[model samples]
Target: MAEEKKEFWRWTESNWKSPDINWNDAKYMTVGIDVGSVSSQAVIMADGKVMAYGNMRTGSDSPNSARNALKFALEAIGDMPEDRMDYCIGTGYGRVNVPFADRSITEIACHARGANFIYGPQVRTVLDVGGQDIKAIQCDEKGKVTNFLMNDKCAAGTGRGMEVFSDLLGVPIQEVGDRSFEFKGEEPAAVSSTCVVYAKSEATGLLRKGWTKEEVLAAYCKAMAERIYSLVERVGVKAEFAVTGGMAKNRGVMDRVMPFVGLERMKTEWDTQIAGAAGAALFGFALCKKGKGRKK
Candidate 1:
């Protein structure tokens, strides 16, 4: 048999719930669905605390993606509490398409709130690297967005860029960070960060010139970091910088970007990708408490 091909762009995903929460006893129940260009998430909150969540790759159909995310979350908790939900909020690129959402909020607001929830009230800044865009947000103590900047014109420094590089190097997406560090000697020059096409061409040339895959990886990662640094500069980096979205998991990129931007990474045990959905759920919880839910 021919050697099996390696897939470098696939990322890890999961569904989880807090084991400590008693779903039946909660006074209020809310849900948040975040449907982005490349992924979708459903978050279940009971009385403002995260009870469960489901995340998956986005498919061609937005409504189905939203429904499937909720289905996965409900299955994880062994319950069908759809009727019990007091409010449901939708957010992200496909927010409006969420069939059951009572309201829609922007991903910037959701991400700010989610970061504040995970990193605490002290979080004042967020960098979200989504599949098709990159966002740098500044928020207040209450997780309200005060200012933000985004780069969506190209895929050079976003998750898609990382995926492209991983596929080219034949390394798993999760391992791209570690593989980048394997390169010894002087750090390679940064590649073009203006466009993924140019960067890909540069990588190919580097490989043809006897550069190791690790060296090419280092150059690509550095370029991505630098590109993001430029975008974040427009928003003005405040302390307590928290990174969210799919790219936060890439330490290879974060390791280079954090230093380039001059800030310490906010540590968190929660899944970074769920910030937007979790924030939307928190908003739903707040709205429910205010008796503003459409269900009411």
Candidate 2:
């Protein structure tokens, strides 16, 4: 029998709602949808506090992904009516395509704001590595964007980039970070290319040359760190740094990247991947409070 093809990078999809919230008592109910190239997220906030959220793998249809994400979020909270939401804001690559969003915001701004909310007022810099791109953002005390830069030119070092490696190694994506560190030998040198296709080829060559899977993973993780560091350096990093987006879960890349940045990362209890949607929901809440969204 042919070897079973393994999907190593498949992360969990989940929906959650805060038990403390009472929908009937929520003064302001807002929603945020983030539809990206590789994932989609929905966040529901009640009176500026997170009430519920859902995350899913994005499909080819942006609108469908947005709706599905929202459905998942509302499903956990008794499936509220859309008209009940005071405002809806959309972010990420497909922000403009959200059919129900009252407004759209840039991912850069949303990420900055979300990072501030998650890490508190101390966060001055954010590093977000997503499916199709990586972003380095600077923000003020109030979560306003001061400076930001993105690397969307290619997929290397992003979520999709790492996914390629995981699949190639027949390792689940969630395990990549830990497995990379399991190698007892000296860490291998970083991969040479920042292009996903080229890096994949390079990885193949290394495997052919007797490099163990763990060694390859370590090398790939180091390369991803180096790529992210270069982007952060160009944006002028500062103290109180925080990382958001799916890649934030990867300790292998983060451990290497932290040394290059020369600063301790600010900690947050919130799910890093939900930062963009959370920020968008906060923006919607602000808009609703200002009487700029749905009329009463």
Candidate 3:
């Protein structure tokens, strides 16, 4: 589980229509799904707002996980008309296997789309912390991404990273964020080792040596945040760096992150975590519009 530098890749379709599309048809409702390694999200767009959003853990197989996520969101949407549900867009690691989608998009694009939509025009860099992947994206004025980097292979700075530590600390994952914000000084322990296996083992030694649980956890958080900061800095650290993805909810990560940056906003808007799904929903709506144009 060592920290590995990875790519923040972005792919946009200039003429992205899948040959399977029948653009002559028109539909009123749209849906999007973002399938990540550890979790999947689904969203529905109707009535000028997101009608439903559902999130679920991805099982051993990712395709099933994508279906399960979409099923959950469809259930949440209740009663949208079947004929009007024109498009289903999919993004994320498992986007290609999302059989129901009209088009598959890169997670980077979806994240940018989702962040720009939620945070408006100000966001230039997006920091996304997924369950199994973490990415830092740089985008221009129109929410179109310019460059990106991703750590799809590691658990060092992701939701899974926190989960592992929570288990070690006997802290619930939901509350880990709240508790980490209470620490008072530089952590006595340094979870600085690159490999998670080594770091976790080192963490135990720190605890056995009489280091308070708070300091050890704080140290771990700091180390993890520093890793994320490196990725953000790679994206150039523009004024409005917004954060999204599952790990965005962790206060521990945020606390350690805020004091180190000179950007206008240290943390990202809360909804950015759901940016991938939201972008999918918007992309679905775009498909519906495309269908109308072909008929005219």
Models 1 onward score TM values of: 0.96, 0.97, 0.83
Minimum summed lDDT over a 10-residue window in model 2 is located at 76-85
What C-alpha lDDT does candidate 1 achieve relative to the native structure? Answer: 0.90
Strongest candidate by lDDT: 2
Clashing pairs in 1: none
Per-residue lDDT of model 2, residues 225-258, tens digit only = 9989999998888888999999988888898899
At residue 134, candidate 2 shows an lDDT of 96
Give residue 189's error in model 1 in angstroms.
1.0
Off by over 4 Å in 1: 1-5
Q: Could you tell which candidate, 2 or 3, scores higher by TM-score?
A: 2
Q: What's the candidate order when arranged by decreasing TM-score? A: 2, 1, 3
Query: After superposition, which runs of candidate 3 have C-alpha atoms over 4 Å from their true positions?
Result: 1-27, 81-83, 264-270, 292-296
| Alpha-carbon RMSD, each predicted model | 1.3, 1.1, 8.8
